[model samples]
Target: MSVAKLVDRENQENGGKDWIVEEFLAFSDDNRFDCSDVLFPQPYFELSNAFVSQDNKVSLKHLHKFLKKWYKDLAGVPWHDTHKADGGYYRYWSFEAACSVILLEINDDKELYDYLYYPKDLIAFYHSFNPTAGEENLLNKYNRIAIKAGEKAPQSGYWFTVASNNSRQYFNAGEILPEIKKQDWGEVYWQFEKEE
Candidate 1:
């Protein structure tokens, strides 16, 4: 019924979070990755400004893959690959950037990579939709596109498709954002405008 319960079930069915770490670690059961104590390391979690988009859908599998790579690559050692801005759950783009990185690592989908990793091309298209010329030409190019955060959006905006609602650009962008305030952040996130 709830996401946490679902995650717990997924873990039980598959393996505990730490157990998942054990497999990727260089250390075996004898000298496993010092992953016994995890700090829920500061990540770009978007629990606050995270609106259940009609387009983007996250599942247990998504969480599994995201943390699997994040812990292995980030927590495996002392150094991590993230920023303080990413820690702000209320901040929009930070979370998206984090998600983009995670998805990049796990999925490595060429097209998705281009969309999330490189926002320059996407921005060009978005702007072009206004008749503003771009570096390339292809009318329906702006259709069915999603940009996480990087070069295009100053902060981190998302471009989504909603058959009837038309394309949407989320102003707040964070993948692993955590809440700064109470449950208010969730509702507050909607007040902001979806800039194009």
Candidate 2:
């Protein structure tokens, strides 16, 4: 579902046709089960469509409505049967709904504050940190570099890490790239920043 959403977003950013979302809708139509005794509920099948729909505003509205009734909708699901031996300790959270909320940038929904399935903390953390923003900024600034940690330097040049303030250091060809350890930024990897 996340991959489909990313593809949809990429297509939208590049002004391309929404073929990925269309393919997903088509796949769902092709895999329809005739019987009513299916393991996955009908709502489960509709999740991807609601998440990665071409019309994001409408899809987000539908997603908000669906999340309101998510817990009640899963009343008779056979999810517990498969995990009975493990004491059914798994959390029954609507991860997809939370992900949709984050991806759609829907922040004004006050009703979702109380939804049990809604991962409020996760959403808060994602909004607060916005890890992708830094990466996107770096990509825009240094589009030529694509090297990562542990990779041998393709050629002798000055390299820098994306998520770190470390100065660009010169590296010899065939030298292994080094990583910077930082708590806030996670693993900072080297990228080709400039020529010698």
Candidate 3:
């Protein structure tokens, strides 16, 4: 009935070693990423985001494969690839970005949106979407907002798709983001107009 209870039941079924599900449970508790039982897609988003956020050390290829296996049918093929913002035009999304999309697409719940879009959380999630080293997109884009906010960037580049070497433009843009308040970064994050 409850997500925690459901997760506990899953843990029991897996002999307490279901790392993916366990990670999701841990994330849910840590981030307060909870939702009402009536919200079906919330569980899916929570589970996927938690799984993706668990380890930034994983290879981007593996991340793509995992997403494809679980999400391809509903979200489509592009959801399995790196986002256009990350220099790949395959319609992919980072874990947090995807969670943002899910909240909007699934229910448009502003409270949940604010929770997921908090600056600290956004920066962390952006970092978690790190790409593997030597991914040849030529023009890899890191989130300046994350770096400027004092969060650590992943050691490896956070990219998944390989674009043409000739058309690449490795520029460090997305800088000059809105200055958010310390206590209510989410409010600022929500109100800040994204410059495209």
The candidate maximizing TM-score is 2
Superposed on all Cα atoms, the candidates' RMSDs to the truth, in angstroms, are 20.5, 11.4, 18.9
lDDT preference between candidates 1 and 3, better one:
3
- Model 2 per-residue lDDT tens digits across residues 1-196: 3344445453445222333234333343553222323234435544544655667666766766777667667767677344446675676677767766665567654556777677778877777775478788876775665566878999888988767675579999899888667678854567777675
RMSD (CA, Å), candidate 2 to true, equals 11.4
- TM-score for each model: 0.17, 0.38, 0.22
After TM-score superposition, the amount by which residue 194's alpha carbon in candidate 2 deviates from its true location, in angstroms, is 20
Model 1 TM-score, all chains together? 0.17
Candidates by lDDT, descending order: 2, 3, 1
Off by over 4 Å in 3: 10-17, 29-59, 71-196
Q: Model 3: which ten-residue window has the lowest total lDDT?
A: 159-168
The candidate maximizing lDDT is 2
> How does candidate 3 score on lDDT?
0.36
Model 2 bad stretches (over 4 Å): 1-41, 45-61, 72-78, 81-88, 130-196
101-147: candidate 1 lDDT, tens digit per residue = 33333233233332223333443343345543562344445332332
What is the C-alpha lDDT profile of model 3 across 1-196, one tens digit per residue?
Answer: 2455545553445323443444445544664333333222422444444344424333233333434444443344444444435664543234533443333232222233333222334444544566566553433433322222222323222211122222212223433322334552332221111232
